[model samples]
Target chain A: SQQGEEDPQALSIQEGENATMNCSYKTSINNLQWYRQNSGRGLVHLILIRSNEREKHSGRLRVTLDTSKKSSSLLITASRAADTASYFCATGVANSGGYQKVTFGTGTKLQVIP
Target chain B: EAGVAQSPRYKIIEKRQSVAFWCNPISGHATLYWYQQILGQGPKLLIQFQNNGVVDDSQLPKDRFSAERLKGVDSTLKIQPAKLEDSAVYLCASSPPVNSPNEKLFFGSGTQLSVL
Candidate 1:
């Protein structure tokens, strides 16, 4: 079973606009990370936010995590056509043995039209 | 640095046949993972390995699926008597061992398998 679920299964926006995607999870997490996939290919790590952190930024990507609500959101500012891809949120859960395992969300498909 | 590597980018086989896929993790990384991604869905972790030891294989179907990482560098995943439901892309990823709660994962261009 997947621990995280992404909202807005698909989003379409014009180039230069901002795209926002949200993710909700059911379990406690040590951290949450977002990734981008193009055409069902390999995934590229984007950014990660720790449980103690509320927000993080990497270039044009901004991620915010609300542990109290068990949800997170990714915002891509000034989107480009190249930014068209599927976005996923993965949760790292602290296991009983102290190791962490990642569980991915269903993902959001974002299309940035030029 | 070279990213995770996977072989036989594509495969087609009939049901009940056997097939195997290979993955070579980034040099010096200690964590390796295999995930199965069905079309239009998220990737599901099938197994995870730390060095040459198995960390988790609970999601893997033991009856038909098996994997091993020899020498803690390269790994292989095999399926005996494949089923149509097994058609999906197999992704290999590796992460460095770090105390941080989050580790960036490098993924390979997955091998797409089609079982007829």
Candidate 2:
């Protein structure tokens, strides 16, 4: 079963505008990571925020996690045409025996127009 | 430092035919995963391996699908008597040891399979 669900299945914005995507999960998670994928290409790791952390930043990307609500959001400041891609959120759950498995969200399709 | 590697970027096969995909994880990485991604959907974990041992395969369709990581470095996924609905992108990924909290996953370009 999938643990995360991303809102705004599709979004279109002009370059230089900010893009925001939200994800909600059903179970307790150890961490949540975001990834981007270009058309017909492999996924690239973007950012990861642990459950203990509330906010994290890397370059133009910012991620926030709210454990109380079981939701996370990713914000891209000053988006560019090159940022057009699909974004997905993956949740890592700590299981018995110290093993962890990641569950991915459906993803949001972001289209940045130049 | 080579990334994960997969072969035959694309494939087409008729229903009930068999197909196999291979993956080679990064050196010294102890975990490997196989995921299935349908059109306009997130990748679903089919199986996970810790070195050469199976860690999780509860979602794998055991009757028709099987995988093995013989040397703990390279792995293969095989689908016998494939179905039309089995058409999707087969993605291979790997991560470091379990203790690392900053572990980042590396993914391959994936093999797009079309079963007619």
Candidate 3:
């Protein structure tokens, strides 16, 4: 079963506008990571926010995690057409064996109009 | 470093037929994962391997699916008597270590399978 659910199943925005996607999960997590997938391609790791961290930034992407709410949000500033893709949030659960069990949420599809 | 590599970019087979997909992880990576992604849905973990040892297979359909990592470098996932529902993209990913959420996973292009 999937542990996380993303809001706004689909979004369309014009270039240079910001895009935001939200995700909520059900269990405690070691960390939450966001990934992007282009059409017919595998996923690419975007950014990871640890349970203790509230926010992180990389390039034009910013991610905020609220463990208390079991939710996370990814924001893309000044979105470009190249940013058009599916974004997914995956929750990493630390198992007793010490490995992280990663579960992905239903993704939000973002389309940037040029 | 090179990313994970998957073979047979596309495969087409008839129902009840057998098919196989191969994956080669990055050098020195100890963790490997295989995920099944149906159209319009997030990928689901099918199996995970740590240095040739099975770490997790709970989500794998043992009746028709089997996987093995040979020599802790390359792996193969085989589906026997495939079903129409088995049609999906198979993705391969590898991480340098386990037990760390900070470790980033590198993914392959994946194999698109179509079961008629």
Candidate 4:
């Protein structure tokens, strides 16, 4: 089963706007990571936040994690036309086997109109 | 560095036919994974391998699907008697040892399979 579920299946915004997407997971995790995917390319890792961290930022990307609520959000500031892509959240949990197991969420499709 | 590599960008096969996908992970990456992504759904992990050993494969449909990573470098996934619902993108990813925290996966372009 998918551990993470992202909210807002699709969003269309003009360039220079801000885009926010939320994700909720069912299980405890060690960390959560965000990824972006263009139409036909592989997913690119964006940022990762550990369970002990509350928030993190990378350039125009800001991510917040709330472990108690088992949720996370990604905020893209000043979104550009090139920012149009599908964003996914992946939860990392260390399994009994001592390996980190990653499960991805249904993604949010953001279309930035130029 | 070269990213993970996958072969056969796309394939179309009739139901019940056999198909195979190959992957070559980034150099020195000890952990590899195979995931299946259906239309509109997130990638579902089918198997995970750590240095030529299987770490997890609970989600893999063993009855028809099987995978192997020999010498811990490259891996292959094969499906016999593919089902129509099995049409999806087969993605291969590699990362540093899972013991290392916060390691991000490097993905291949993926093999798009279409079962008619």
lDDT of 3: 0.92
Tens digit of per-residue lDDT, candidate 1, span B29-87: 88899999999999999999888889999899999999999999999999998999999
Give the per-residue lDDT digits (tens) of candidate 3, residues A1-114: 788899989999999999999999998998898999999579999998889999999999999999999999999999999999999999987666556778899999999999
Report how far residue A46 has shifted in candidate 4, in Å.
0.3
How do the residues A1-114 of candidate 4 rate in per-residue lDDT, one tens digit apiece?
888899999999999999999999998998899999887457899999989999999999999999999999999999999999999999988665556788999999999999
Residue pairs clashing, model 1:
none
After superposition on all CA atoms, what RMSD does each candidate show versus the true structure? 1.5, 1.2, 1.4, 1.5
The ten-residue window of minimal lDDT in model 3 chain B covers: B96-105
List interface RMSDs for the candidates, in order. 1.6, 1.6, 1.4, 1.6
Docking class of 4: medium
Over 4 Å off in model 2, which ranges? A95-99, B99-101
Error of 2 at A89 (Å): 0.2
Q: Runs in model 1 with CA error above 4 Å?
A: A95-99, B100-102
Over B14-114, each residue of candidate 3 has an lDDT whose tens digit, in order, gives: 99999999999999888899999999999899999988999899999999999999999999999998999999999999886544544877899999999
Model 3 residue pairs with clashes: none
lDDT of 2 by residue, B9-108 (tens): 9999999999999999989888899999999999999999988999899999999999999989999999998999999999999987544855778899
> Where in model 4 is the C-alpha error above 4 Å?
A95-98, B98-102
**Least accurate stretch of 10 residues (summed lDDT) in model 4 chain B?**
B95-104
Docking class of 1: medium
